[model samples]
Target: MKIERYLTNKMLLLTSIFAPINLAAQERPNIIYILTDQQTATAMSCVGNTDIHTPNIDRLAQSGILFKNAYCAAPLSGPSRAAMFTGHFSHEIGMPSNGIPMPEDLRGLSLGMLMKNAGYDCVYGGKWHVHTPSIPNQTFGFRKLYEHNDSGLAEACSAYLDNNPHFPFFLVASFDNPHNICEFARQQNLPFAEIPMADLADCPGLPLNYERNPYDADVICYEKSLNYSAYPTSHYTADDWRRYRNAYFRLVEHVDMEIGKIVDAIDRNNLWENSVIIFTSDHGDGVGAHHWNQKSALYEEVVNVPLIIVLPDKKHAGAELPQLVNNGVDFFASVCQWGGVDLPDGLCGVSYASLAESGDPGRTHQAYIVTETLFDKGGNTRGWMLRTQRYKYILYDKGRYREQLFDMCRDRGEMRNLAVEHKYQETLNKHRKLLYEWMNYHHVKQIRTEVHLIPGF
Candidate 1:
């Protein structure tokens, strides 16, 4: 469908003018969803990363429950955010890469629409990259607050909250910062703030897995060589990567400064006690891991993102949960459920609300989570990552080394490939079968046969 038809300024004005008055919006506790762009799970100081100081995001971690092993549904922006808002995988929605507009049907089921239908006043601001960088207020059931800049988005969110629109509001303050590291990688200027500077000795050092993985997929090198616009770091030196890491952390901190404003607004307006606040990113950046820079490769640095949830009355405050969460689907499902919306049948997203509200930190939510990516256009070279409790399995189509297995417990750096070892073939086969089952259940008709071609099974 021509999704741009819904995003025009005229349509936005129309949505704002005729939007229903929801002063009596459902009283099922307010929900505040704060999202940042391209922030890795470890970029926050709360995670013990000494290179950055994110006081605001760190405060969220302190006042909420943090999930350590959360994965994105996809590793790129357009597909990832599409999965997030629609509660579907990239392939399910035909949004496998950036710039692919979301189908019209999913728009009606998005978070904003779901909350609105549940009788909550919904408002969205900042980056919505569900194909385009702009959100269509009419279709998504949201009133656009302001533009996509981080500082302005924060100010707009604070002003909106301070004005006290109505009860049970679903507010999305999506900031586009840390994503400026994309420009930093290309040696271009960061649009929002001045890029921080540091000498080689002062900057953070290279990661331990700075070198390429042993027996890594060949498609990675081929795609990098083919797309220098994304991976300009293919030729970067150690000092260069340190400098890159320096700037990336600074950009992350830059966004945290704006997040502080939104958090302060929630407190200033006395919405803290009755609100469910969630903080996360659409996807993660490589941050110099395994010589990788931008996302789309199914590395740990790209898929593992931060998931922090602050429930009403600060339930389980300062606790860390290790449950496996796919924020793309689970996020949509959880927020909708919390807003008192009954989900339609045939949707399989399992919500993490129980885990967050329960007292069992030792609870196991899912055996594993799947993350799929489309690196090249037309799905020529796509990849599926199945992450289990202690192992990570990766499979890519059309690559010489098409499979990689890592014991995540021992090799979090992913420097070793157990898929190459005959002793681990049985374990590899089990993961393959799991992926096969997942694809079959998700109606993935295109690649079921491709998984059978890996030979060891």
Candidate 2:
């Protein structure tokens, strides 16, 4: 009888120890998502751009999972962010450009709504650019909205963190400082100031394809008058390019300072132990890359973006994931999976939650990234691009088909166009087919747009 009693006691002790393990696995951590506006992948020091120093951003990468090949679903703000929120492509929810609403019924419920439904207080501070006026107030489904009304988005986030005290919360701390006046002056109402390039660096390296080439006529004409030029204006002497880059770095530094405030709030509240932090941006700016200013092109200058995620209890800390991840499509699903919420049906993104925990997300198949730009910034259509690891193919057929392809492996700078080259026809055809398959899958209109702008001559 004593032997049986002893065995029973041991079993009970084991159960007690394992019970908390199960509970910890089930306990949902507070989620803090920090989204920056128009930040390129190269801007952050973690991504290999030695020119700029982003210590705070670097720290986040050191303490979390750094995604080396993260990409924006679309290289523009409104559409990219919409995809992040709804987990649906721009067209899937009827949002193809800025200032478009993702109809309430079509929202089908979103990650924020799901978190709110799960009893987590959801707060949004700064840069809520998704339009909803047509549907009236609507709360935009957020429990509390701060809209980063000014340059103190991080301050607002810190305040919100203070008010929450010990509650498990989900906060989207979006900032607009780095976005600045050049990209979308009206989007954030950032007043325009053409700070001369002379005040900045002198001889900043221009994109490889910056030289005025024979084939540049079509693209250059489209951009010169539009203010959304493919590359930065050649008219600005070398010093002009330097000043632009300096201003951009300054903008980034300001945003980083604000990010420090948010981090401080978490530490002060002692929420670090129970909070999962994610940092990224909607898309990238050309900065000095490819001599461009804003996105809307297929080059890496605009398409590639930085992505970092840190989980509580040092889960998957200091890890680097080099797999090509489609942020627009895979981000929300991963967020939902991490938060222990049931994914909204019909979501287009994939979940990296499992691999994130495992620390080594190895690699995945070459996925296609599609982007659509309207002609003249507001017309019916402009162009569409499909980017894989080694190649990028663009179709801009307003009246006649205009196709361009670059072998990224050989011409990482995209200086050479292998599209019309007789020898590379086979490679071009393969990528073209893949792009069409993707376009069809996403229901991209078959109507070909025009090559309104070209930068590399």
Q: Give the best candidate by lDDT.
A: 1
Question: TM-score for every candidate vs. truth?
Answer: 0.91, 0.81
The local lDDT score (0 to 100) that residue 378 gets in candidate 2 is: 32
**Residue-pair clashes per candidate, as listed?**
0, 13
Q: Which parts of model 1 are misplaced by more than 4 Å?
A: 1-27, 376-379, 447-457
User: Candidate 2: which stretches are off by over 4 Å?
Assistant: 1-26, 132-138, 165-167, 181-209, 212-217, 220-224, 227-234, 375-380, 399-401, 448-457
Query: In candidate 1, which residue pairs clash?
Result: none
